[model samples]
Target: MILSVALLVPWATGAVLVALDGRRRAVGWLAVAVLAATFALLAVLTAQVLAGGSQEVVTGGWPPGVGIVLHADMLGVVFALLSVLVLLAATTHEVLAGIEERVFPGLVLLLAGGLTGLFLTGDVFNFYVFFELAMTASYVLTAYGGGRRQLRAAMVFTAVNLLGSFIFLLSVAGTYRVTGTLAMLDVGERMAVVDPNAALLIATGFFIAFSVKLGLFPFHFWLPTVYAGSSPAVAAILSGAVANIGAYGLLRFGPTMFPAQLRLVGAAIVVLGAVSLIYGAVLAVARGDVAESLAYSAIGQVGYVLVALGVGGPVGLTAAVVYSVVNALNKTLLFLAAGIRGPLVAGAFAVGALSVAGVPPAAGFVGKLEMFRAGIVVGSVPLIVLLTLGSGLSLVYMFQMYQRAFWRAPAPAGPASPLPLRLLTTAVALLVLAAGVWPEPLLAASGRAAEGLLPGAAG
Candidate 1:
């Protein structure tokens, strides 16, 4: 009952809100109130899961194989909570800044519902369905400002993601054909006995699809255009909330469903992660635009998650989850700050920049520390060196962008941002600081989430 209500609140509210003119302050606040309610419901659900166990429901009370299953374990719940928090922040930020389009608030609610559904789903086909629901909302949100640059970004994003979705659908079809099951756990168990060649091929398809969504190197060409060209709130939502789909998919599908394939490609994944790290950092340094630099920074930041994932153990998986959470917060703060200018805005941006550079007293430091631990646990000298060099490059690029954006004298500043906007941005930065000041909760949650995937090793 809790699971079903959690899912329904956002969808039902969003459906009604979409018909309203969201540019009206009342309608906007109504949407925010509904999202806040949804978040509270998810919080209740999370507490229940933590105190007891996974909460699951099969619609209509049918058998597991026949009914659609919604499962909430630590991993899925953590991601779901983090994603909605990001959405709440981003949506609130946009509303404070004044929503430009009539559809903005409603689309955000729809996207939130889609993301929550994707995270909680226990079935692969339903995962795809939720994935499309989220992507469709994002595609429209990308063009929220209705500017030429934004329209172009929407086109590129839609085209690339459409291809990725097509590939994902095909992979789902192949999984069903090979295993005769759409349930993720059943697919994982059955994949072991299926033809290795077919499994590997299907695994590769999933990998590519997720990689495209993640904007990983070699598949990252479309990312900068979209991130740089979109409105700040939209960019933040894309990087902070939407990008989780890729990371969550990788963590869920990799070691669990296709362990053999993951082991086979682990080395290659680490190498690609390294490439993305250095490539994005180097390119970020070369870009002059603040948004473009941060876009590239986003590309580099996810590299650490990949590196941890490729390391493939409880510690590594924990690092992946931790980094994913911190990265989302960091990007959300920076993107929102980038769009505003006033008292406390520069300081807020600086905190975000420090976090990105893995400076102590910022949440990113914890994530970086976890990555180093993962590398050391594996006794991989190259991985450690890569991490060290990546950290240094991250600092350099972040400093450059900060100096360029905030430190330089402005020609003539426009009107200062609203008080609520500044306060909201500062609040997010302080959350990052608070997490760094006391990381026990983040670490514990991440460890538990990792244990859910790997089952025994100390995270």
Candidate 2:
């Protein structure tokens, strides 16, 4: 019941709001109110899942394999919660900055609903359905400002991701053909007995699809232009929220359904992660534009999550989950702050910079610490060395951007960004700081999320 309501609120409201004039104050605030209500519902669902266990509802009350299932467990709810929070913050930021488009508010609501549904779904085909819903909204959102740059970014984003989607759809078809089931749990159970060669090929398809989404290495050429060209609010939403689909897809599909294939390719995963880490950080140092620099930085930041995931254990998975949460917050704050200039905005940017560098008194430190713990647990000397070097590079580039943007740069000749915008960025920065100061809740949630991937853990 809770799961149904959680999905219903944003989706229904979004449909109604699509025809409203989102540029008006009332309509924009109304959209924000609807999102807040949706967030509250998800909060309730999260509490219920945490206190009891996984909560599931099958449409039409049909048997498990027949009816589509909306499921809420620790892993799904946590990611869903984070995704909504990012959407809420980004939407509010745009409202404060003044929405430029008539449909901006409704589009955000639609994206929120899509992301929530994808995170909670149990059917692989339904996951793809919700995933496309989200992507479709994002494709339009990428062109929010209607500038030539924005339109080009949207074109590149749509073209490249469309390719990734086709590959993903084909992979889904292959999975169903091989296992004769689209239910994720049933697929996992059946995948073990199927031919390893077939399973490995399917796993590779999934890997390529998710990798393109995350903009990993060779597949990453379109990312910088899209993130750098979009408006700050949209960039925040894309990196902080939309990018989670790839990370979550990797976590959900890799270890959960294809453990044997994952084990076989673990080292390759780590090597690719290491290359992305170095390449993104080094390129970020050379970029002059703040948004472009941060775009490259995003590529580097996600590498940590991959490294932890490749290590593949309770500790490693926990590290991956924790880092993903931290990275989302960091990117959201930094991207939003990058567009603003005023008193205290630099302070907020500094906090984000420190967080990205994995310095103390910021949530990113907790994520980096978990990565170190994972490295130690795995007893991989090279991994530890790589982690150390990556952190160093992250700090160097972040400092360079901070100094150029906030410290050494001249005051803007135009009026400062609005007070509300600055305040909102500050609030997000404070949240990052609070997470670092009191990390027990985040750690516990991440631990529970990781457990969901373990064998014999409740589905």
Q: Which is the leading candidate under lDDT?
A: 2
* TM-scores, each model vs. reference: 0.97, 0.98
Candidate 2, run of 10 with poorest lDDT: 408-417
Summarize candidate 1's per-residue lDDT along 43-106 as a digit string, tens digits: 8888887788777899788988777789988888888888888899898887787788999888
lDDT scores of the candidates, listed in order:
0.90, 0.91
Model 2 misplaced stretches (Cα beyond 4 Å): 413-417
After superposition, candidate 1 runs with Cα above 4 Å error: 409-417, 455-459
Query: Clash number for model 2?
Result: 0
Candidate 1 least-lDDT 10 residues: 409-418
